[model samples]
Target: MPLQKSPTGTWLPARVPQSTITLAILLVLCSMVQSTTGGYDGSMLNGLNILPPYTDYFNLNAATTGLNTASVFIGGFFGPMAAGVMADKFGRRIAIFWGCIITIVGVILQTAAQNIAMFVVARVFIGFGTAVDGIAAGVYLSETFPSRWRAWGVGLFNDFYYVGALIAAGITLGTGKWQSTWAWRAPSLFQGIFSIMCIMILPFVPESPRWLIHEGYYEEARTVVAQTNADGNPSDPVVLTVYKEILDTLEWEKKEGRTMSPKEIIKTPVARKRLLIGMSAGPFSCVVGNIIASYYLTYELDTAGVTDSTDQLKANVVLNVWCLGCALAGTHLVANWGRKGTALLSQTLLVICLFIIGGLSKKYADNPNAASNSLIYGNVAVMFLFQGFYSIAWTPLLYLYPPEVMNYSIRANGLAFSQFMLNALAVLLVFVEPIGIVNIGWKMYMVNASWDIIIIVLIAVYWVETKGRTLEEIDAIFEGQKHSTVPDVEAVRKGEATVNLAELEKEVAATALIVEK
Candidate 1:
């Protein structure tokens, strides 16, 4: 459905320094840390998969592996909510900076871990720190950028996430030493360093303008928002318009009811549902896509004749390279088509692809190879297709949507709940995946594919259009059709709910102290 603008007229631009490149650089640098942290986890997933094979190295069994894997996710589950709350209680910069400290400590503990028990404990800290960074990245990027580039900025900030996975794959391949501890530990340590560096460097960048505004630091907020290079000062016209809107939104919000607060997130039905949908959508992507990929790494490698550490590394390199292609395709399609349409269609196509890949995998397993390696090659091709298509459509954007779905009140809480569900789903799937490969064989792929089909149905039925929708529009949708489809008493009476967060940001930032006469 096409959107109708409320009195706010959808998202309005907040002018920033002309040096958008500097802002872009800070955003990208932040993403590198995002990618690196994820890369560490991806490496662990791959390395741990192979660990079960070499009992002598880790002395790990299925039960231990389950505990270890689940441990990290369990940690990740709570960390986002905690970060979100702390972020609000304090500020974005402190929340993120402290997350780096936690991350480094977690990495050190994990690196020195002498047993699976120690490893599991350390993993929790890692999960906690990582979640803080990830959620903080989402909140930070959204609040930091102007509206015109919001989607692309989010996407671009997140793209390095996939790129991080590729880098981790390459690191694994380069080592050709998955049998050793460094195969996993080294990546974690390296990423920890990167995370810490990001925190240290963040001091040089400005704080979130909206956040500054929210605290009623109007002068500082204005100076930052209207900052420039030629004279490095705020221009008069820019200052006036920005100041006006800030007052406008605050007045409109008061005219409506109460000032927005996080506690009110679940107070109403629409707010409650928005929180649920927002949180679930992100981690849901992982439950179906990422966890499944991590689960089946070994089985796929074996099918491709990548049995040993060396060969397995080679297979990953191939998958990594192919995955980049798929990421590109997925991104291109989604950009033009819109998220819901693309997500539904991709999920539809994924079901079909999974059937083909699974069926081909079964045949390849039985025959191993035939007609000059045609069957295995075909299987590999399908696997690539599965990863590529899903990577593009399902990968980055799934992470994007949930956070976008909710407004400020319940954003963190919603994300926290969803990550918990997602982590739990991942744990079950991860455990089931290996067992399925050994016991159920190619039938498991059919199961995953079928499950996705069911999820797509859910998507079609309940999924709302989020692309191009402002945060308020999303909140309206989340508030549900009952609250939103017909205008509210206020919206009807006033002809719209007029809130310009852009202007609210100005007074909130309190730029008077920062701006020069």
Candidate 2:
């Protein structure tokens, strides 16, 4: 079956499972705070030059400090893969509940570390624990939200990380303990708190209706859908049709047309292409520029020939703050423009900044310390611009893309797989990042700049726009039609499929061409 769409101008009650929504929020919060637990690890690598208060604490070395930051990604790599399988086999709630347990153990290990090796190992465990939130949260929201509100629900997820950063910043700043490794430990303890809260209340939250049906529990499925729908203002037609559609969309498949196996998922043209598209998104969403930007403070500017510590520190601080400006711009433009267009514009800006900065580093390498800071601040200022463009275009919205490309039956698994690859890629980059700084000099930044340029070109060439679109409409768009019945407004009106007929027909015509080929 291709897809069935309701006529335009239809809206019904929005479905946001209250329990799932709350659990998703808490899960995201855990991730936000847990990530910042290693804030000082990056700065610690370079601190080998001067012994801090506990300079001999475990006889720390640059290699171990680097391991500390990189371990999170490494542990995170396998963690999500494991969690994804559990979610499919068990339940999202259970996956998250156990994730907290892992995190608590990791944090306790960090706090009690008597040696460098112990610290690194502990960080790995913590990474494993944190990874579950990414998969569980994404699926939880996707399952709980109606098709119309799914994007909005997921996009809001990243905002919590920003909030988490603020909280961490305040905590570390307040105690004046950022100088100590224990400053970071405080954040991890909070994860335990959050996990316990979610677990205590999870029993009250209903299971996903779709998942329930998939498991042959029709009574539970209907009960959940009806309850969730009753909480909202449902259109008469939507009230009549929503459950019917939900049941039809999610029926357990015994064969190809009815349901698909994981192997067929990778082999079928439509399914394979979607997975690949999601794979591309997984890397781009987190890698290249964003990763580099996140670790800006870790690298030493003095070796690049900046002699003055104050100036280098100021430059670094300014660069990170500038990212907020870029993120703000991204928040505004992401919805208005298509995903491809937003990504193109932002990436192009990043490329420009990289070239300018790379040239300035070369030009000023001899100066050591420039008294007049024009180019230093100006191009550095654009770094934020680079961030702004990325935030609006790609940073906040990529999670929304994976679910749209896949159909109802496999959207959860597709996102879980993409996240699995994403965490693995992040781990690889984190491990590689330390080597790049140690061996490359100014070349590390230059390499990322080059990567961003290539990313822009690839995005412009192959990436598709997915804003304000429906699942059926998206499937239609990928099929190659010129138009689709995707909606443009923020909120949907009751009973409306809200797609463009011309676009849908055009895309259908194009999809036919792909098959003909």
Candidate 3:
């Protein structure tokens, strides 16, 4: 049967039930906590670094400060090693809950730290927990949302990171005048709130239907598919189609003896390509010069002649707000422009902005007194533009693109490995950025801009568009054969279409035999 279009010409039914919308909102809110907590941790550290009390209390120099900032990634580096196993073995929701619990413990330790050693240890835990939570949440969001809503659902997940960052920046800015350790400790203590929110919301949300099918809970998976996609109408054509597709795909995967092992990722040419593209989001996001602004904004601002602490804090607040707006806009862009197009546009603009900023900074930043006010201001303006463009594609795509491209068998593990690479590289760069800023000054931006030019080419060559396709349907792109056995929903609804599961299974077996022969 041919695929039929909705009368309303939208991806979903025009009049979706209110209950479905409510469920989607809840799932988005719950999944958003991982990024929100991360944003808060990063912005809090950035804000605290600017405060005299935080620097004085820790006795931080460039090296120690880099160690302190990089410690979270160090912890994150180890977390994904176990994140994949926990998410796959236990369940996505369980992994998220436990990860949040671990983060809360880290938050408590960080709040009461009397020495730098205690603080660093605490950050490591926070990093580990957040990493685990992040991978699970990314997979959960990608798996649970309907195909029509998946891009926005997963895109907004990381956009909320700015929400957490904005809050942390505001709190730290407000508390900057305090002459005590609480100025820094207060922000540290607040990092757990988002995790706690995630824990609270998880009970009200459903698990991924795909995960349910993978674990042999067919009825439960079907029920979830109906609840989320068809508003509890089990007989609805959309629900039936999705449910059947998931079943057939999983059945085929099993007959082919696929496993979730890492080795399976590199077992074939297509699999290797999928792994490379899925992992690309990690390092591409980290290497784009955002690290300098994310963790070392104060240092960057000082070099640009914004020497006052108050001014710097205010700039941090504005930058987070700006990034949030741009990231939200990017969610819409991905739907209209497609993934590859939006990324290409964003990367091109980033290169241009970074190049100009480098030139302006090199000319004026070294001699702020001798520089004209407009020249100094131009450098700052370009910096904001660079971040804004960065937010447009990289921020939303950071979490959205990776899981969409990977099949269920390796999605959880692939996400973990991608995150591990991100953390590993972040550990080095976050540590090295401050030193680079102190030693090489503005040339760092130039170097980073040059690197981004190459990234644009890689993205053009490697990334595939995943717009407007169901998770099971995406496998067709990778394997050059449609995995879904479901027919048209409209035909199914009219009782004009039927699927023969036994025949489908026989066909799959025959295909496998041909491959072996």
Candidate 4:
């Protein structure tokens, strides 16, 4: 349906089909599995010997613990690259199905781990499985949903990752008192539950209609499109219009003989912009110092004199709750404000919080008196704000913006390349974060503060607006072709005048246009 303006002044679809909601939820669950595993690892830091559940369990020091944490990123680095090929060649359904299966095995090994080596290996498997899910779910959602529902679909998928994070924190808090290995191991086992849920849902999910069209499966694509429409009517103009757009785009690609392989995608300037945007997301979010706060919160808090494990768990839960809440808020913000606006606003808030957090933290570290307790409290509050603001944009946009901007032909490959860059940096930061915490302390926040400004400038200058536009229309924008605005998707569905792309292009080309980066 077309977008309706709310009293609050946000544009949203008038009605969304049951099929779209179901598919988005399933994808969100798939994405959640990976984030749950990440959350488990992050929360696990709380149970280490230094804190309350100080079971002296996993009696490891900073360097070793960091290595174990980095193992996930190591697996993540390779998994997406492999999944990209699998998703492109084998189809999104099969790729996510196997990814879930792999995750199940990883969770088992992690839960039953007899030693650090075994646990690390299991973590790698979990990372690999989730990375595969990331690529498949992202590409599939972007391809399946209509333009009106696209932003919300991607936003929910991004939001659920943090939902998994909150679940992990809650699990840790609940299990902290357990005296046995089960304390930490139970949370690891919970990681597989999301993957299991995804596997169950996959049987009911359809393959991407666009992928079907790209492979010349016209009948299959058309049927899927029809089923995806609000009334499930095959002859619905909404269905036919989208089908035609896909066909026209594919025909153009075939006529031009434009190769869309990973190498070729990079070689094309416009396609490469999609990859760069995707790749940039990871560094922007991770480098802003959230990674350190996420994985090593217990350590960070401990250094600030909040050394109790139970207290650390409480703080972690509160922080995660705030992050998750902001992520929920982001789903609307992204749709209302557009990606570029939301990102700019979010980054600005993040920079402000980081400076306050950094300055206060430095004071608390330099002087640990009761007077500095206020500094500690203030820093903690701002840290929560930092996470909240980060979630408002960076959380969803990191994954959402990339696929929206990517060409359908190479969507999976582009997403994989982005994931690779993200994890590559993750590996470095995950390992170095612990060391940096020990050596440099609160000054580390300053580093993130500095990067946030650069990231903001880059986004303002380079990010394109994708709000209220169809995937096909987005292609025209990046290709520098003039395409008339599609004011309302519901209008096209009703066989309105907006359905004709050729006429629309002619009209658009005749008028003076303004494009924003």
Top model by TM-score, which number? 3
lDDT of each: 0.60, 0.53, 0.84, 0.71
Whole-model lDDT, model 3: 0.84
Error of 2 at 353 (Å): 2.1
Top-down TM-score ranking? 3, 4, 1, 2
Error of 1 at 206 (Å): 2.5
Model 4 per-residue lDDT tens digits across residues 68-167:
7788888888898798888877777778778888888988998888777887898888889888877788887777777777787777776776667777
Q: How do the residues 1-517 of candidate 1 rate in per-residue lDDT, one tens digit apiece?
A: 1211111111222322245456556665764565457655665456545643323446766666666766777677778668777666566666677777787888899877778778788888888887777677667666555443455666555555556666666765654455576756665566576677677556445555555655665555555545421112354443334343333333333444533455656777766777765665765476454455554476665655446766565666567667666666665665566767877877777788889877777776676645236666677677767776777766656556666776655565565566667766665666666666767777877887777877787778876666655343454464443222222222322335444445544543453333211
Residue pairs of candidate 4 with colliding backbone atoms: 463-517
All models, RMSD in angstroms = 7.9, 8.6, 6.4, 7.4
lDDT of 3 by residue, 185-287 (tens): 8998888999999988776677778777777656666667776777666566677677777777777787778887767777778778888998899889999
Across 1-517, the per-residue lDDT of candidate 2 in tens digits comes to: 1211111111211223344344344434433333333333322222322323233555545565456667767777778667666555566555656776787788778767667677678878877876775566566555655554555555555533434343433333443335665544454344355445445544444555555656655544545554444442223233223433444334312223534334444656777777777557777866656554454343434434444534544444454344444554565566566566776777777777666656665565546466246655554555545555556656556566676676654565677677778778877776676567667655666887887777877877766677665454465565564122334222323534454445444443443333223
Higher-ranked by lDDT: 1 or 3: 3
What TM-score quantifies how close candidate 1 is to the native fold?
0.81
Report how far off residue 245 is in candidate 3 (Å).
0.9
Worst ten in a row by lDDT for model 2:
1-10
Q: What is the lDDT of residue 252 in candidate 1?
A: 36
For each predicted model, how many residue pairs clash, with residues at least 3 apart or on different chains? 18, 29, 0, 1
